[model samples]
Target: MVLAYLLSVIFTQPVVTMEAEAIQPVALRPVANLKAKDTPNDAGQSIDLSWELSPDSARVKRYEVYRAESAKGPFEKIVEFLVPTTAYTDADTLLRNKKDYYYRVDVVGELESRASSEIAGPVQAKPEWFNTNRIPVLVFAVVYGLLLILYIEFAKRDREMFVRRIAGLDAIDEAVGRSTEMGKPILFSFGIGYLTDVATLAALSILRRVARRAAEYETRILVPNYDPIVMTAAQETVKQAFSEAGRPDLYQEGDITFLTADQFGYAAGVNGIMLREKPGTVFLQGVFYAEALILAETAHSVGAIQIAGTNMATQLPFFIAACDYTLIGEELFAASAYLDRDPQLLGSLKSEDIAKLITVGLIVVVSVVGTIGAVLTSVSGESGILRSLTEFFNSGFERLVSFLTTS
Candidate 1:
């Protein structure tokens, strides 16, 4: 009798516990405080939605977002978040501008159990005329414009603007004089460039300077061009330079002639002139490619004083190694301002320098701040002072980036 009574108690207790466990409810909770609004600082046809997380977020398998033109009846699911998320931006093409929208968020739990938040409504997407977040960019642009204008005015007022001398340009007279003393011709090649090229245009300014000096010294200047249009322009430039130097009679149109438009063909023609004439000074300016080294070396073989200037970087090292003087990159562009010292050009050049200074200063400041913030974050551990310093630096870094990049 005792054994039967014990067995009945054990089996009945096990059954009761199992039934209670099966009946216990799954704790599912809906998201709350759902909000929807037009996205800021953007073109029309977008809306932003946000919500508080469900209390049973750990059990949530995913969150689904729905949109409707009206709050009542059918709503279509526009997007879903497989992981927990608090916010979403609906930039779908179907979202029309100025049309009202309603949004709802649903928390899906394990085993298909679902709960939904109250609907959020009456939001319309619209475009903004100006993005307020880009105020920093506008401010910087305005400041640069004002600086440019002010400098131009100062230059026009006859205020002496100090400009550093470019050695390549300053040697123009020396190169022409050397050819004059040696009683040999000056060879100038506009290596395979069209009149439409900016580098070719910049080279024209340097050509004018060389031509003027050559005219003053009564030395013959030969300009071999690759493009016929460029040949015409070069002829006019040299004529003007000679007229400016009061030596128009010395201007020779035949000296500035077009060679072939073919790349290597033009280079060979220039090389032939360098070899036959064995010029005292060779001015290699404008666009050049594989022929840069060939021309520079040929001029060197003729024992010519080579003054090379081009906007091409690939050919610069070859010229620098083979030629006596070389103008690197933007120095070729700045030739007009440096040689002519025109007020407008000087003002523009100086303003660009100031702009560059501002950019470099900002970059340095940001780099230092970011480095310090990272170091502080790693060492803060348990120290409240260090942690506060880390937060301060991090906040400043974020603000700087946002100010520069956002909107």
Candidate 2:
């Protein structure tokens, strides 16, 4: 009986061991056709790797990427993916330019069982002079540059370049004259903007024109600033304008004064000046925020003719509501060219308009094609002719949209 029991136990133990070995996880198959190449249209120090998925992809837990300086190498693990993947870009900072790189991809399975592909190597990363993806942008830039040169030559030859009249800018002389007639001060506020802002810079150009006009009219102009730097610039600009107007003695340094840097504080100060001095004209030009309406409303209350301009879209509505003349976004930027009529500036502005026309035309064409494609796709009942037309329009639309977005 004891011998029989011992025999049965030995037989059962061997069977249990065999069943356990059968149920153990197997090593996943390695990925195939691994390829590595220099990344296109990019600066050096990047390599693109691609490979075929493993036959045992169902069993794969993750993919691991290993990189080395040479084919026969101590490869360092660079990256890993928890899900199945076939491509990776090794853009690690440690990768040096013009250096050869070798790569291997491993398909890892449950219990860390892994199979590695044959190493792909001898690929070097090099920078391209120009990115093909940005060719559209390059073309646009070249065209704009050529247009600028052409228009500049025309302007230099005294050819008349047409510019639309901006009523706000045209009214500057009128505003200054009214102030002179009423015996009231002309107030200009650079609304809570630093000297670094483009809106503020544009405002400086407009201020120069206004200051020159005021000097000619012998009107007292008050410039209240939110920034000290802006105040200094305003002083210099006014001084220059006064000299140009042949009224250097009329330029008062005290008029272009810096108020508190705080947004609301500056608004309160300017509002107080408007109320007390009863300025005949108020120019609110530059960057503005919540204080825009406050200042504009106060100037309105004091019976001031307000001319407002800003690039801030959020504050434009308030300015338009309260001010007599509002210079919308691009109009404010075009002030320097309009006021100065510099040949170079006028040429640049003309080129900008041409570019805008081209952009708008492309947008319209793309929208028409995409809409037609979508409509045909929804209605066509597997007709060959309709399918062909749909493909043509959709592909064209997609390409154009992609180009526009990338450019």
lDDT of each: 0.91, 0.92
What C-alpha lDDT, on a 0 to 100 scale, does residue 255 get in candidate 1?
94
* Worst 10-residue lDDT window, candidate 1: 398-407
Best by lDDT: 2
lDDT of 2 by residue, 1-407 (tens): 99999999988999999889877879678999999999999988899999999999998989999999889888999999988899999998888889888999999987788999999998999989989998889988898889888888888888888999999988888888888899899999989999999999999999999999999999989999989999999999999999999999999999999889998889889988998999999999999999999999999999889999999999999999999999998899999999889988898888889889999999999999999999989977676889899889989999999989987
lDDT string, candidate 1, 196-278, tens digits: 98889999999999999999999999998899999999999999999999999999898999889999998899999999998
Clashing pairs in 2: none
Cα misplacement distance, residue 3 of candidate 1 (Å): 45
lDDT for residue 313 in candidate 1, whole number 0-100? 90
CA shift at 377, candidate 2, in angstroms?
2.8
Residue-level error in angstroms, candidate 2, position 125: 2.2
Model 1: runs farther than 4 Å from truth? Answer: 1-142, 192-196, 381-407
